[model samples]
Target: MATHFHKKPNLYPAHVQLKVSDLARSIEYYTTIIGFKVLQRTGSEAYLTADGQTILVSLIEIQNAQPLQRGFAGLYHLALLLPSRKDLGNIVQHFVNLNIRLGAADHDVSEALYLNDPDGNGIEIYIDRDESEWTWFDDGQVNMVTEQLNFQPILTAADGNWTGLPAETVMGHVHLSVANLDKSEQFYTNVLDYNVVTRYGTQALFVSTGKYHHHFGLNTWNSNNGQAPEENMVGLKSVTIVLKDEHYAEEVKQSLNANGFIVENFAEAPAYGGAQLFSTVDPNGLRILFTLDGE
Candidate 1:
């Protein structure tokens, strides 16, 4: 399958780092239920990958970490984009066999399955509808809606085969529960240079780099006036975006500096092995890291 990583100057979500209370239990859940292969396991961390090499999710062991709170500015859901409708249907059937509860949605542009990890962190597994079928308005924004998902067609797409994540599966997007929509929008657009693709009233905003729908979803629906996660909270640790090269990374760093956003090089960042990092925190306290595509 062809790679889905966007081209140069476009920031694409690469992976997400989540803080979990139990390392062993979370590892089992990801490997068994989510069907991600364990790439590497450090002392207190385990790196998971789909297709055996492309790193996707990182699980850091935080012993005795506080369970994630209800109304905090943190991860709403980390979406895993599957290769095709048949791939999604196969996984859904596997979940059915295991009796795993899930929430389903047809967002017009995509079919999505929602569930939570063992630690209550949200996960969205989805496959996008063909671009030819996506509708766009005159305002240069794509139309997206939440409606009932017709599962019969999805089930019929499956061939009853079971396997791990496909090579084309990627971290399609990350949705965040933020405290303020305005601040989040400004930080993402002005500093990070993402174009505002769509908005929902004043409560939610979707932004993207290459105009393929949203790469990040920001919403204040459940976290209005909410505080950031505490130090010990088991929630989002950081979000990683892949740039094409060091030059592109520096260009983004310069842009962020021009917009008064502090840029730091995190020597201890989690993903991309030890690639150069341009890291900063959003208005709602979500850590965003930009790294090269490891070319």
Candidate 2:
């Protein structure tokens, strides 16, 4: 799989925090079905890893947490990028063996399979086609389309041996349901400095740094003019973006302040281990945590 898109110098999502109603059930689903291993656990929270060390996803068990509702500004899905086509096939066969229902699609740049967790938090597992195969237009928009995925070819690539998530798996990208496309687009592109890579009419847009297809997919399909999910709801809590270093993190914080956004520092938090961490809410109320790489 391509590494440059997610490495230092490109702003990308590295971790996600989700609120779920049942910790054990969600843990079971993530481990057994999604192939994540537990990196840490507390009474009410669990951190998951694809490799043995990095925390890719976290689940916080909310007391009396409500089910995920539609028309809210929250998670659309957090995508997991696999390393190879063979790995994708292995998981597909595993899903078939477990009788899991899925929505599959080919997006020109990648092939993806979608499913939801026990708490209805959406998840996407996908493999990118080679970068050389991608099409770019003169206006700086990368071509992408949703079409039927040919499953037979992917299934045939499986070695019939399914384990867990590969060590190389990374938090590929995140798709969000937001209140307004224009505001969200401006915040992501102008304030956060991501370039617009693609658009689905006026309802949705894709943005990324370093010319990767996209690091974020923003859409108002179900959430146009809607409110954010309540704090006690079972859904996305925050998404963490790993910047290249403290310099970039500071730049982002300054940009947020300049744009009339509130940036809160969490640098002294024990959980963050003295990293220069800061967080701010987007226009639609989605919280985003900004931190440096290797923190």
Candidate 3:
């Protein structure tokens, strides 16, 4: 059988859940700076949407949530992908106007802007380059490099329209800081069946399905052999990976069990209501939700 990357459609990163020390402060930052609309707020938790309908981010307020520790196995960043370069330019201009300190990068597959939320959670706003423009290596890997981003050209492309995140926006990818590369790779690749698109030597690895560059990135730059974040620590709670095909979801459960990984099936839960999905923990103690279209 062909590998997962050669499949018809890839799994989509639906949403991310984060624990924050202050709900009000985090909500303001996400709405004003990141351009997310408040879908709903229930008690100490708030659901944020990019397209005014779907919940893409959730923030749960914890009274004594500890700050994320360096070199810990947890979230590195959650990336938001714009539908077009023009949309990215609009946000870039907004950042410039607000004097937000941003870090920019030109990865061969995408152009990205990086920032941190009020509680120091990492965020990446980016747009993917055309697939035809991507360069592929003989090893079935794509060339992705971090170089200086030319701001002038991107700024010139802006149409000067200031609005919130477009309806087509999506949670592009999630990068994680893991304790062990080999163990994480075994789970994400061997069991989950993602294709390794590329690597940054021994420090990082990128994996994707349907050959669309990357949906997940794992790295040990600052987290090698580190401990998992504490329960009350402010960091990643979980990331939802949505599979479009029901058969694929069943296959994933079988693969997880065969590989000795435990899987919990949630028929209908408030977290992902109306969907038949399963949850599993990676070697580094990160929660991954695998779901089908509907129950």
Candidate 4:
């Protein structure tokens, strides 16, 4: 007789949600500075979209919400994908025009521009290079380092030329800060089964699936041993997940507990990065997640 055992599954976010205090202010900032399209809005609640994906970025009124706090578990950063460097360049121009406190960097495999959304949530707008252009380590970990981004050429040539380029894009990645790096890594890898691509000392862990670089990242840059964020401060609200199966979600939950993780999810959680997910917090008080894909 042969012994057999099941496998622990991986998770990807379904859709990450955010609760902003001021809908009108959020709408203008997202649509104008960040380039997110306004899908719809009602009173103090509003919904926004990036590249036609469906879900609501509910901007709840803070009047009745809890008081905001800094360094709490909430939205860290939502990565917006661009088709090409040219598109990234165009968007950078828009930000430059408005002086949106942008942070620019070239991560060998991708060019990124960082900023905060209206609600003070971190936002990253970026475009990736081809696989052939990626520099990998012996262990398949990409040699991702910040390089200086020269936005002169792309901006010099055009204005509002990003949408003209055609390429499939989605929310490419999300990076966060947690209270404990090891605990968070365990939840994301052992529990979520997200492959670790690299790390930055004891402070960070980078994980990913397939071959698209890191889709999830956690670090203790700040907020180590942090408490749960107050409802008031603008930060991560909820992360969406699509799963492959209920069994998969359940399997993942078992793994997290087995690995000594503290995970929280609604109903039955399934495995599948695009399908199922578990919205959680790490040691640094960051909003972390694992989601599966759709069936």
Estimate the lDDT of model 3.
Answer: 0.84
All candidates: TM-score: 0.94, 0.97, 0.94, 0.79
**Candidate 1 lDDT, 1-295, residue by residue in tens:** 2234344556778888899999999999998999999999988899999978878899998866998886789999999999888899899999999999999999988899999998899999999998778898989898999999999999999998968777778888999999999989888888777889889999998998767789999999889889988878998998888787777678888988887778998666544433547788788878887787543
How well does model 1 score by local distance difference test?
0.85
Candidate 1 worst ten-residue window by lDDT = 1-10
Report how far off residue 103 is in candidate 2 (Å).
0.6
Each prediction's total of clashing residue pairs, residues at least 3 apart in sequence or on different chains, is 0, 0, 0, 41
How big is the positional error of residue 208 in model 4, measured in Å on the Cα after superposition?
Answer: 0.6
Off by over 4 Å in 2: 270-276
**What ranges in model 1 sit over 4 Å off?**
1-7, 267-274
| Candidates ranked, most accurate by TM-score first | 2, 1, 3, 4
lDDT of 2 by residue, 79-182 (tens): 99999889999999999999999999999999999999988889999999999999999999999999999999898888987889999999899999999999
What's the lDDT for residue 245 in model 3? 82
lDDT at 2 for candidate 1?
Answer: 22
Candidate No. with top TM-score: 2
lDDT of each: 0.85, 0.90, 0.84, 0.62
Kindly indicate the candidate among 3 and 4 with the higher TM-score. Answer: 3
The TM-score measured for candidate 4 stands at 0.79
**Candidate 4: which stretches are off by over 4 Å?**
1-11, 56-58, 64-71, 156-159, 162-168, 257-295
Pairs of residues clashing in candidate 1: none
For candidate 4, write residues 197-278 as lDDT tens digits.
8777787778876555687777666556666676565666556544457687677668757766678764675221233356
Task: Give candidate 2's TM-score.
Answer: 0.97
